[model samples]
Target: MFAEADWVVKLVMIGLIVASIVSWTVFVAKTLELRKATLLANQVRQDADALRSLAEAGDKPALAGSAMVQGANAELLLSADALHDPEGVKERVASRFDRHEAQVARTMTRGVNVLATIGATAPFVGLFGTVWGIMNSFIGIAEKQTTNLAVVAPGIAEALLATALGLVAAIPAVVIYNHFARQIAAHRAVVADTAAALLRVVSRDLSRGTIAAARG
Candidate 1:
């Protein structure tokens, strides 16, 4: 059917094929990316939970480059100049976590929008190909002045093939796009939990410092 398809229909089929390729490519890449990041995030969160205080989170070689670690470290430095006030420190750390979470979400969401675009537009693009194929077929039939089933079948079949390709390209794109959305949301939640855990560490460290100052 594709072999005999009109030039316009062929172009539509090629475009749909490219869209399908792009959608699957994104799926594979994101699956790997999300899997790796989630594992790292979870590990970092667990390590942060086991710490006695932010001081115990020192160096963080194992947790290096993690959003939780970076946010906590940056805020700890900035908060130190505030006279180790726990309330001020925790508030600032929380703000940094918010930005870090947003940044992580934006990073994870990269390239996912193409899936949505393919899913939403593929079917309509196929419909256009189908319409064009059928219109061309009708024009030929009119010129030939023939109503034979054999004469009518091929054109109709070719036109419908465009719609089929469209659906083929569209359905999985929609499904994968939704799957990525859920994955990203789950990762975001993990990040929030990590932030909260580090916040507790920050508070614990400040409390100990305050107590030591009182004794001194």
Candidate 2:
């Protein structure tokens, strides 16, 4: 198996090993990032829910922990007399929440592209190594002026090894990439839910403020 493989095929195998290592690293990093993002998004949802309850009770200060909530509260506080403008209040809160959602999504998506690229390329790299190995094996047979199973077996074995190695690298990369993608999608959903909760809080506050103004 060793004798039939040319220098080029060996080099390709080395390159594939490097690629596999890199792809694995990206998978690990992305998994960690997605887990962290999911946790943070859950926290945000809880915080937003609490803020919504406070708003329902005519208190906007309950949203102090969340920057999106804080911005909404600040806006409501600033325009104390503009109680009739529920639409404006809703828009401001939605905008702030959207910005936060975008930020969170950006963080959650990190390293995913690297994983994706590795998954797509690793197989081709392995195939190249196999092709190069087979060519070298044929060249060796030609030079030796003999076609023997023993002589050809090594080259074929090396080619198959290269293909196996490529698959070994690629399969994990593809799996991890898909896993990360699902995590990101879930993260986005949580963020969107939190944003909706924030909007509700802001809208409730606006409605209460309007009623108070009419009474005055």
Candidate 3:
């Protein structure tokens, strides 16, 4: 079928195929990343002891990928600064947690835009090829001066093939893009909830002056 396709149609099919491949690649990668992030957020929420252990270790880079851990660690650092007012420390730590939550959401959503672009444009690109192919088919008919089935069938079949390929590439892209969008949103909500838990821990430690003593 590809061998029979016009050069322009062939290029369109190839481009759409490539786009479909890239969209699937992005979907798989993002799915894995979001799963890991969600797991990390859950761990932080479920195990206060482990969260404190991470902060006490002062190994900021060890679990840098976990937004909850990052926020907890930042709160520890802020609490350790003796010169800063207690109220000011809480504000700074809260700000840092917000930043980490935003970063986690952004990281989890990376590469998803490519899927969106492919889903939106692949059909139109295929339509362009179909139109081009049909135009050429009509030209062939005029030149051969025949309305014979053998002469018209092959050309019409080739033109329809572009539309088929276009839908093949587009439908999955659209479905996957929407699925990832919803998944990412849910993951972000989890991250935000974990950050809120960390903030509560920070508040309790500040009230007891435990954070400063731990720093000492």
Best candidate, TM-score? 1
The candidates, ranked best first by lDDT, are 1, 3, 2
User: TM-scores of the models, in the given order?
Assistant: 0.91, 0.81, 0.85
Model 3 lDDT tens row, 1-216: 678888999999899889888988887788888787677666655564345533443443434455555565656675575524667766777788788778876787688888888889999998998898888778889989988877777667777888888888899999998998898888777767766666666666777667766556
Q: After superposition, how far is residue 87 of candidate 3 from its true place, in Å?
A: 3.3
What TM-score would you give candidate 1 relative to the actual structure?
Answer: 0.91
Candidates 1 and 2 compared by TM-score, better number: 1
Q: For each candidate, what is the lDDT?
A: 0.84, 0.73, 0.74
Off by over 4 Å in 1: 210-216
The residue pairs found clashing in candidate 3 are none
Q: lDDT winner among the candidates?
A: 1
| Stretch of 10 with least lDDT, candidate 1 | 207-216
Q: Predicted candidate 2: what Cα RMSD to the true structure?
A: 4.2
- CA displacement after TM-score superposition, residue 15 of candidate 2 (Å): 2.4
